[model samples]
Target chain A: MNRIACIISYDGTNFSGYQVQPNKRTVQLEIEQALKRVHKGQEVSVTASGRTDAGVHAKGQVIHFDSPFRIPAAQWPKALNACLPDDIRVLSARYAEKDFHARYHTTGKEYRYRVLNAEDPDVFRRHHSAHVSYALDIDKMRQAAAYLIGTHDFSAFCAANTSVIDKVRTLYAVDINVHEDELHFILRGNGFLYNMVRIIVGTLLEVGYGKRTAQSVDTALRTCKRDDAGKTAPPQGLYLWSVQYND
Target chain B: MNRIACIISYDGTNFSGYQVQPNKRTVQLEIEQALKRVHKGQEVSVTASGRTDAGVHAKGQVIHFDSPFRIPAAQWPKALNACLPDDIRVLSARYAEKDFHARYHTTGKEYRYRVLNAEDPDVFRRHHSAHVSYALDIDKMRQAAAYLIGTHDFSAFCAANTSVIDKVRTLYAVDINVHEDELHFILRGNGFLYNMVRIIVGTLLEVGYGKRTAQSVDTALRTCKRDDAGKTAPPQGLYLWSVQYND
Candidate 1:
């Protein structure tokens, strides 16, 4: 059997999420089903780098699977793409070491959140961006994002139901870019907790709206309470931009 | 009654076409339905600059309607948008002269066709562009496009079943621009026949693939025979970019 690593992109609009759930349409189920068809009824399990929530898009998601077929690495994308749906595409595939894991071997990740800061929402971007009619002060948002960079225990920004004990993670960068009527928030980090990036964006947006102060983000980090931060942003605007690995 | 002209945008993925048909969802039907709701059961008729086929998007389509409401011109978009669906949006609205007509007062129009010239289709652009896997010679396409410019009888580049007697039209510009892996065909013309732009694109694509020489476009224009040109491209890649009007 050969181990294959694949980079995939998916439009998460119709998916329940990236994980397999009973009877729910999901990205994992589609990928595994396509693999099964390619393997001629032999069940094949696939593992992704991580799970993304429903309605969250992906540009460079990584996955690994073991297959008994002898297809070349470069032709795997073409083969699998023929069986996959239009919304999920296998961008590239390559042979990987037997010991390589898509999930545990991941070193860092990059995420992006898009906001349409316009009076009226764009019809074409309805599924790709979140609309914010209220004016946002970009300078204040930048100041609040500055407080989010570097190492911090992001328990205040994490989801309440997550059982992960260690909330400390090193944030490499937080960039807020303006593209005409859209605001793109790019975050890079060694790791992120459940809804951490969304919460951070939500808090920073509140600062832009004058509902919170830049110093309040520092206070939230120190307090480490879920209520200290802002509400979690919606899932549609978030994208798992890329995954990093130390090969 | 006051005449109001509005600039609108639509995704066009879910509509049958721009014109209303019995029991079919259309852009015109949606806009008229929204107007009816705004008028509280009073019927309102809308006239657009032109009709676009199913799956053909619009960025700045012009429409005119008569309404009895005395709402401010600037607030018309917001008021009408509240009643319209998410796939359609009113970009702007303004009062127009009583003699002005959306269909008859148009001076020119701009249309764009997007082709994804890549090995693999992008998931995000599935609904926005047409995927062409084969490598294209852009220079050949540009040369063919140049032959299509200026005033000519475009019967060879129009749909075979079109009943329009006069196929003569003046094409101001036919530009083929390369942006990364996508090729954009922008056409500005005084008018177009049925499937004119799409047929032109299909003919140019044939030239790009070396199936036909650039000189064939000139021959096709001279002969004015439908079979002399290539097939008609699909509608998804076509966008009614904007409509021109001389005030």
Candidate 2:
């Protein structure tokens, strides 16, 4: 028996989410259906690195599944793609070592948020990004982001629904890039709490729009209060860019 | 009454086509419905720069309509966008000079065709582009394109369904750009025949696959026969990029 890991990408436009739901269309259910076909009528289950919210895209999501039959790892992508929907694609597949886990063995993760900061609507980017009509001060947002980097108790950036208690998380980097009329936020962290990235983005946007300051972000982190941060940004603009695992 | 010109963009995935059809959702019908609402439930019609096939997108499609009531040019877009669907957006609106026409006065047009030449599927671009599994020779396609440029009687490129008699059209440029795993073809001409751009693209794709040569395209033009060219490409890959007008 072997654990096989594969990298997959999805558009997320029409999906309920990455999780399996009874009656809803989801990325997991679609892939699982394809896996069932590949296993010749035997039901198969797949575990992903994490669950992306509804309408959140993924560029390189990692998943692992136990195979009922022997198959080459390199051919997994092609075989799975044949059975999968066009919106979901397997990019690469590889054999994992014994005791390998897709979620528990992860070392870090990276997420990106795209914002279209323009007056006129861009037809091409309607689904891929969140539109902000008001101009943003990207440099100011960068200044506020500096205080969020490194280890800290990020209770202010987390949503209220999760049952997890441990609030300490190490953020490696928080970078913002401005292109034409778009602002992209690339975040790297050891682990994120529920709604952490979106809340952080919403807070940073306050700084961009002159509603908050870098010092305010530092205070928000020190206070460990959720209300200290800005509103949670929409999930549509967020993407699970890539995942990191131990070598 | 004043002539109003507006630039609109659309996804075109759910639209039947640019023109009106019975019992079908179309770009024109949507806009006309929106226009009717803005005019207090009075029916209104709009003339477009040209008609695009079903499933074909647009970046800068122009439309002109005569106003029944006086409204500021800058206000038209905001008014219409409120009633338009999410797939369609009014980019800009302005008052047109006396007798300014969207279709008849157009000087030239530009069309773009996108092709994803890769084994791996690009989930994000699945709707906006055509996917080809085989590798393409861009240089060979470019060579074939060179023969198609300039003024020529393009009877071989027109669709068999069109009733237009004159086949002479000026091709200003034909550019093929390769980016990573995608190939983009941009074509500019004084005017286009029904399905002319798709036919040209199909012929160029044959050249890229080594099935046809540059000389074959030259002979097809000289022969002035529809059967001399290749098959018409699919509409999903094509976009009405822009329409040139005399300022």
Candidate 3:
């Protein structure tokens, strides 16, 4: 038996989320169903690096599964894609080193938030970006994001009602890039908490719109309180860009 | 009463085509319906720069109409978007000069064909691009396109059963731009025959794959027969990019 690791991409417009739940369409459930078909109705459990919220897309979401029968590493993508829905696709698949875990072996993660900063709506990109009509001050957003780099207690960025108590995380970098009327926020870090990336984007947007100050963000980090941060941004605009693993 | 010109954009996945038919959903029909709603059931007419085929998209489609009641140019987009479906959007609106017809007064037009030349399909971009698995040589495509950039009797590139027999048209420019695994063909011309762009793409793709040579394209053009050219490409990969008019 071999453990197979796969890089997956999907359009999240129709999925409830990445995690499996009862009575709702989800990425994990669909993938597991496809796996069962390939395994001749045998049950196989799959694990992802992290769970993405509803309407959140992914480019390189990594997963690992143990199969009773061996399929060629190069053919895994085509095999799985044949049984999967049109919105989900397997980008690549290969055999993993022994004792490697998708969640635990990760060294860093990256997330991106896309915003359509335009006076008129783009019909084709509506599902992929958050629409903001007013002009944004990208410089102010960059200033706010600069304070987020380095290790800190990110309690202000995490969502409430999470059972996990530890909020300390190390952020390697945060970047804001503007392309024409599209604004992209890319953040790379050691790890992220529940709703942490969304909260950070929402906070940065507030600064960009002149409603919040960069100094306020620095204070929020020091306090380690959830109430000091901005509201969580919508899930449609966010994407799990990629996950990094140790060499 | 005022004649208004509008720039429109739409996702054509659901529409049959741009023009009206006996009993099918179309972009023109939807726009006319929205116009009727704003005019209190009064009849209104809409004319486009050209009719797009089924499953074809448009980025800068131009249209004009005579309104019974005056609606300010700035408010036209908001007024129409309120009644129109989500897939179609009015990007901009302005007053049109006297005797300015969408189809008649145009000086030039631009069309784009997008192809995802990759090993795997991009799920999010499936509707907007044609996926090709085989390797394509960009240099070959450029060589083939060079022969199509001048005035010629383009009957070989036109679709069969077109009533307009005058097949001569001037192609100003043809550009091939490669972005990683995505290839774009942007062509500008004084005018185009029915399905002319799609046929050109189909023939050029053969050259790209080494199935045909650039010399064959020149021979096909000189023959001025439909059998000389390759089959027409699918409509989903095509887009009416823009229309140019006198300032």
Q: Which segments of model 3 are wrong by more than 4 Å?
A: B21-25
**lDDT (Cα) of model 1:** 0.93
**What are the TM-scores, per candidate, against the unseen true structure?**
0.96, 0.97, 0.92
- lDDT string for model 3 (B1-247, tens) is 7889998999887899999998999999999999999999997999999999889999999999988667678899999999999889998899888688999989999999999998788987888888888799889889889999999999999999899968999999889999878989999999999999999999988888888898889999999888888888888899999999896
Best by lDDT: 1
Interface RMSD of each: 0.7, 0.9, 0.9
lDDT of 1 by residue, A48-160 (tens): 99999999999999999999887778889988999999999999999999988999999999999999999888888898988888899999899989988999999999999
* Chain A only, candidate 3, TM-score: 0.98
> Which pairs clash in model 1?
none
> How displaced is residue A69 in candidate 1, in Å?
1.1
Candidate numbers, best DockQ first, in rank order: 1, 2, 3
At residue A126, candidate 1 shows an lDDT of 90
lDDT of 2 by residue, B15-104 (tens): 999999999999999999999999998888899999987889999999999886677777898999999998999988888986999999
Candidate 2 local lDDT, residue B19: 96
Q: What number of clashing residue pairs does each candidate have, in the order they appear?
A: 0, 0, 0
Q: Candidate 2: which stretches are off by over 4 Å?
A: none
